[model samples]
Target: MHRLLVVLCISVALVAGAEQDVLELTDDNFNSVLKQHETTLVMFYAPWCGHCKRLKPEYAKAAELVKGDDPPIALAKVDCTEAGKETCGKFSVSGYPTLKIFRGDSVSQDYSGPREANGIVKYMRAQVGPASRNIKSIDEINKFLDTKDTTIFGFFEDPDVALAKLFVKFADKNREKYRFGHSNDPDVLAKYGETEKIVLFRAPHLANKFEETNVQFEGSSESELSTFVKENFHGLVGHRTQDTIRDFKNPLIVAYYSVDYVKNPKGTNYWRNRVLKVAKEFTNKATFAISAKDDFQHELNEYGYDFVGDKPVILARDEKNLKYALKEEFSVENLRDFVEKLLDGELEPYVKSEPIPENNNAPVKVAVAKNFDEVVINNNKDTLVEFYAPWCGHCKKLAPVFDEVAEKLENEEVDLVKMDATANDVPPEFNVRGFPTLFWLPKNQKDKPVAYNEGREVDDFIKYIAKHATNELNGFDRSGKSKKTEL
Candidate 1:
């Protein structure tokens, strides 16, 4: 089954250019591409997928049919066998030649089985309705404004059977409101058909806006299905997007720079306290939270912001409209005032957030260092050195806890230092594979900073650190007594 998917995917990619509606998805541009269009037809495939290979030609024929002057749909192909693990995982694409249709940024339809062109074409017309215009490229889809009527989106791969199920459910319910379709076609990728799925919509008279309510085709047991919906349904709830974000109409974007540990004596507390006061004042009308110190970039990307070097910039727009966003520099007061200004119809002189405090201007006692030696060294206490990038989300989620742990152990027996791995240098010798890697080194043996713990849990990591610190201070071999069973 996997091999079949791989074969189909590679073949489809080869012919993707022939179909204007169809597209190829990669990690670098998948989100941006989807954001630009309304819907899409995707085929998750791999080079090794034999079933996919067989489906390629059929998919191509479907693409050609859908590219007619009045063709009804578009098609796309996703090569999951490459370095697209993250992209595939995000969409919960588990199998090859998994057919799915994305409406806005979420999956609106999906398909599997019977890899034939006619079968695929029949499915597309049934789901999205007859295409109003012929389109051959994603660029053309971008140029084409969507109609006001029903639209169909499709994707296919063998492992995406569950995704197909969700699409089928939505299609059944909204048959008149919209047409959702898919197929695991062999021989070609339905590029033009896929592209049509995105730009076409039900005409306003025919469009049932009332039926556009939240119809969650989801459950706890169907995580993969939900993920597919989240990534493809740009307007779905729990998955933030320009349209979905409108759900938080009177929302507040909180921007905080303090690490949990450095929040207090570091005088970052002044701002922290002030933010709480501001948060309370606008509690009913706004929603906000502190950003992860490490996840600055991810935050920016998630919210579709440009830069995050400045302290957290609170960005608020109509929860229903992300396009009309308001961003302000540090301080909850400034942010509140900006929101007031927006509400008041004064849209000029918006304040930009302050850039990160650098060098002598830094608020924290630990200054940003360029190299290992520049990292502060302590002898009496164990040292916890964290190597992190400024863009990681998981790292951001763990920031507060990391800070708290350091603050609790401060001055007594441990030194906590943070290093910018991307900006400075992280040697391969350290075996660091991912971001926010925590290295624990005994104060006595400063040169060898071994990998301590990874992942997001704060309490578990703190306990592990304390245990190692105790051993180091008691004149015991810090690396002694292997925990692993000896052969």
Candidate 2:
């Protein structure tokens, strides 16, 4: 009995270890496996990618769920960094954890649905047939609506219609979120009380008794259909990942509130409800999204907002990558005012990575984005500017030397300035590509900023400035003493 118990424990352990039912494919056998499996889902991943690591368990669970289907759907993975580099390259896998579906040797489609076990399984099952189902009877249409959370039905007069084909393509991309079916039957069309050639029906939830809400497309253009679906279907946008955030496009306003939906549901609702009220006011102008503090710390840092503070932070980004933070408290009135200022171009954008100086006492006057045009562009004195990033080690090393150079040239006509390139946007003509990049902007010749390629020592800077300056060097000597002649 003891031996039998030990054997049973070992068998359970083995089964648990074998839970990863996904097939591992190499460059050699990838083509052969694709040839054998009629429908296969391939994931191109890298070991170092965090997203790929998170997707592994979910993909394995999906694999286990669909391993015994009628034609047996196959889930395969290839490590792009290793033996599968060629295979991944052939598929143009630019990003890690790219999923592609293969239907025999002739067809391949990029999978762009939700990255969850159940979502993946549902999408793969849908891909086994045509993107949109053909409903024959009213009972079939009702049954289909009952199964899906959201169902879109296209009632077409004929099977080979243009709108029907467009609806199928749209459904194929969004199968994870919506179910699509088309009916040419007069009985099915009559049940929905539609006479138009193309009509879209949005079936309500099962809890709501599947009440069908629909709209008719008057125009046959794809853009008209797409706009109708986008405007009506996407009720609210919630950003959970970076990919979803990017989908919102530029000129997006995201509310980074501290509320745990799982732990403190009330707090979450209170925060989101406040943002939702403001979101509704400007829905047509900008995309409004709510992001939990923990899930969006990286984005917060990128936009130069603090997520570890007491109050929630609101941030907006334009198409040009310019970021703005709302200084006012989280209220509907304050948010509305903030958005108004943003749209009116009254708000000042700032870079988070730049260091704010304590004072301008040092010889090098710190230039920031706010005063960049005033200090550097409008100044009458010839300016030697050092564009440096705070995190650069080489820039740190040169700080003292730059300060000394600034002191030596203080009495002269030239002004030595330092600007944090990471935080400030220099003029386009400056072209600061690297850290500790120096440029000499002549007094009246502001448009022609000359790049400094000489050594980083004080002597090298002094010589370079003296050589290029329009005025004579008066108060300083090369050996750090008062002189009459040019150093």
State which candidate has the highest TM-score.
2
How far off is residue 98 in model 1, in Å? 8.0
Q: Write one digit per residue (lDDT tens) for candidate 1, span 204-269.
A: 222222224222333323454434343323221111222223333344444435433224423443
Model 2 TM? 0.59
List CA RMSD, all candidates.
22.9, 8.6
Q: 124-158 in candidate 2: lDDT tens per residue?
A: 87777676777889888877776423456788776
Misplaced by over 4 Å in model 2 are: 1-21, 26-36, 44-73, 79-129, 135-153, 160-180, 185-188, 197-216, 229-233, 236-241, 247-251, 257-274, 302-313, 317-355, 358-371, 374-487
Best by lDDT: 2
The global C-alpha lDDT for each of the candidates, from Candidate 1 onward, is 0.52, 0.74
User: Each model's TM-score?
Assistant: 0.27, 0.59
